[model samples]
Target: MEEADSCRRAALEAVADVEPPRLHEYLDSILDRASMVPAVLTLESAAAMRTEGRVLEDADEPHRDGESEPDRNRTQAVSSDRDPARITTHAAGVQLIYEGLRLTRSLAHDEPWTATDAEASDADLGILAADILVARGFYLLARTDAADKAVRTVQSFGRDQTRREDLESGAETSAGTAVGIDGGDPASTDANLERDVLELAVRTGAVAVGETPSPRLHAVVAEFAADVGTSFPPVADCLTDLHARARELSLEDSTTDRATSATDP
Candidate 1:
């Protein structure tokens, strides 16, 4: 349990420090390190359940509750051997979920737009943060109970749709009504959106950072977005847009890789 807690803390800190393109890399590293605890705990739990089943079957033969004390003791002995690891996994899972929450909060902590209105603000940061939180919640849900709870909490918070207020505020900010506008280009804005979504997807353990929509992934995103009263159409549209952008970026990356390789020779 202590080890798990330590892993969670370390993972959270690492993610907090990660920059845009590198966030997913940090998450992958942390998850790889922490993966062993749950795997071991799952095996131990399965073994205990099997043993408990046999003991229950034997106890049903002829004994009343009080008379099965000896059998109960034996069953407990076996159970005890499994308890520490199970506890450790549960604790670790909880800690990881908490870390996910912390990450989300940190991302949402500020305004989404920069003072210049050209880049992502602290609010936009929160949306990106929430995206990662939702994805991580899905990944961890398969391994831990705490992850399910985290998913529920995030679901309660609503989806990733751009609210009217947000759009209006953003437009105003970019137009220089708030602070002076930074005059960032459409390409930069699009790139930022793509980068943020891809970062979230990778952190959540999607197979690749480029375009490719798994139904399960879409379902997860839909659930998260449902809170904002976003219908499936817009959600689908957003996802398609992200995927298209990711594919374009991937092609660019591939071209760059080939060029670099060619140049090296």
Candidate 2:
């Protein structure tokens, strides 16, 4: 938990320089829980990569010897580098916020899976709130020059969902069967959803910065995304350690720690 807080604070410090001030309040509202592990993890990973060539040295740090500026001046930023990793980190966080809010509204109603229930007056406020979140997500993506990747991600999700619906329309639902265990399998599991969103955000950030990520970076995002999607499952008892492992992976060239990975259902 403490590590997560440190990451959150560090990410906030970096993001504040590029994004609008008021937008941060919205991020705070969305990431107001321990369950937002995905955004936190993604933010930490990208922030580490973003600082690879540069120094953190945010405005809040104390001045060196022979400096004359007052403490008030310390609140200023250091550089205006539009780092790709940092940009995608912010975009991913926005996407997670949108998904979390939308999922909450959709699952809050009596018929949790019913599409119509979430649009009713009872859930109007939540639905509207989710709408704003998605808008904010698009805004951030475009601001970072990841508009194309963001568009592709959304289009992919739509196609996947439509295909799933089409499959279900012609499939049979017998006793004791889940949605994807039967003939409707489209590899749409909970973990994949988390991985897809995480990869999309990370890749979007990387793409915006005109970076061609190595296979290790892609693996890192997938592994971390699984952790976020499963709510830090297998190693939930040792989240601080898990975070440490993830940080080490982000800052160096290292293989994944499969021990912390979530189990398949």
Candidate 3:
């Protein structure tokens, strides 16, 4: 346990500085952990390849496209330029998170699978590894988006001569201040953005996609629509109604299943 804690700390420190001596210590400790041996080795190998400036063919290559040479070359260059250490870290972090989730799920189901059991299941390990890779990909994309947003926000703020008092007073503000270039109409634009994001997320290999509407979300949306003087019902209401129907359908399915089982020999 102490070794594991030390490894975690070292790993955290290694993220910022690849040359950190603690990195080897962390990797070694991870190697010591019987259950996490495979994951640890995978991470260590990736890190070593990174240190040696060796590119992973599978990771560095993007899907081919019948595009212009400049565009294709640029895409390949960008993929190659991505830091392997960062990729390894992201992958390891995602694997750790998923393993924790798996353990929790097993406990919740009262079919507690031990570390040994986890080690035995090659299929389960592969599935977890794939999930980790996909999760890391999503995280990298999100991080890039956040960095881009931050840069744009800073540039906009620097250019704008808007005052805090003016914003508070609802005074006429620059379009840049009121609606950011990236910010589009919430009703149509947000829906489209959500769809695009969901599609991209799935394409990047998200294992599950779900949206849960809060109970009071309907009221909030309705109030907003009323304030806008729009005749359309709130999106939250539609989601909530769909959820209710789904629950009803699930109950009916359960009843049917029970009846069928009862009638069976």
Query: Taking the tens digit of each residue's C-alpha lDDT, what string does model 1 give over 1-265?
Result: 4343444454454345446755555465545443332222222222222311133223234545575687676554434433444434333333344334434544443444544554465345545554563454355334432344445544433332222234445774565543212133322222222223322332222211112333433443334333322111222233444344434544554565567778895
Per-residue CA lDDT of model 2 for 151-219, tens digit only, reads 665565555455555555544344334555324564343234456565655555444333444466677
lDDT score of residue 190 within candidate 3: 22
Per TM-score, what order, best first? Answer: 2, 1, 3
TM-score of each: 0.29, 0.54, 0.23
Report the CA-based lDDT of candidate 3 relative to the real structure: 0.34
Q: TM-score of model 3 relative to the true fold?
A: 0.23
* Highest-lDDT candidate: 2
- Model 3 segments more than 4 A misplaced: 1-35, 44-82, 111-265
* Candidate 2 stretches greater than 4 Å from native: 1-34, 50-78, 81-119, 171-191, 204-212, 226-242, 250-265
- Return the number of clashes found in candidate 1: 9
- Give per-residue CA lDDT, model 3, range 1-265, as digits (tens): 2322333343343333322454334333432342322123223222222212223344345556676778766555445434444434433343343233333233322433344775546335434443443333234434432223223322332233233234434453543555443243333322322222222222211111112222232333333323322121233333344334434443454465578879999
Reference-based lDDT, residue 105, model 3? 30
Candidate 3 residue 245 C-alpha distance from true site, Å: 53
